[model samples]
Target: MSGSFYKVECPDCENEQVVFGKASTEVACAVCGTTLARPTGGNADIEGDVLETVEAR
Candidate 1:
């Protein structure tokens, strides 16, 4: 099954960006360069607010 995409809001800047749920590497905010998610060997550990979840089609 395909993984999901998350709409994350940076806690520091409130910048919104799409991040892979199973991201292997660190996912950073585009505007503020804040860590949005980090690899956890499974699903990434989301560091900010998850505004939405988009399932892969």
Candidate 2:
């Protein structure tokens, strides 16, 4: 697999973040402070069914 940093859209705050080499327990929206699903593998393994957006603005 390609080991590189990539941006992931926060399903809560809609903030784009580079998740690829940062250890974290929980991820909150960088813009709206909405708590996101627990990031798998620091933050690298982002972009997937990790979040759910019901209604957005």
Candidate 3:
């Protein structure tokens, strides 16, 4: 699957961040340093509140 961006809100600190859908590495919240997403080969395993799916232009 193609990579995409997603808007996610940290459950711990409620900080919002943009993350890669198929991230090859772990993604963390910038504000609180909370673990947000983990790489899972295809789509990343998200651990935050998914605000929306970002559309590529």
- TM-score: which candidate is best? 1
The regions of model 2 sitting more than 4 angstroms off are 1-4, 37-57
Model 3: how large is the Cα RMSD against the reference?
Answer: 1.8
Q: 1 or 3, which is superior by lDDT?
A: 1
lDDT of 3: 0.89
C-alpha lDDT of all candidate models, in order: 0.91, 0.50, 0.89
Find the 10 residues in a row with the least total lDDT in model 2: 48-57
Better of 1 and 2 by lDDT: 1
* Model 3 regions lying over 4 Å from their true place: none
Error of 2 at 23 (Å): 3.0
Q: Candidates sorted by TM-score, descending order?
A: 1, 3, 2
Instruction: Please give, for residues 16-57, the per-residue lDDT of candidate 1 as tens digits.
Output: 899999999999889988999999999899999999986664
TM-score of 1: 0.90
Residues 11-53, candidate 2: write the lDDT tens digits. Answer: 6556766454343566556677765445566433343233332
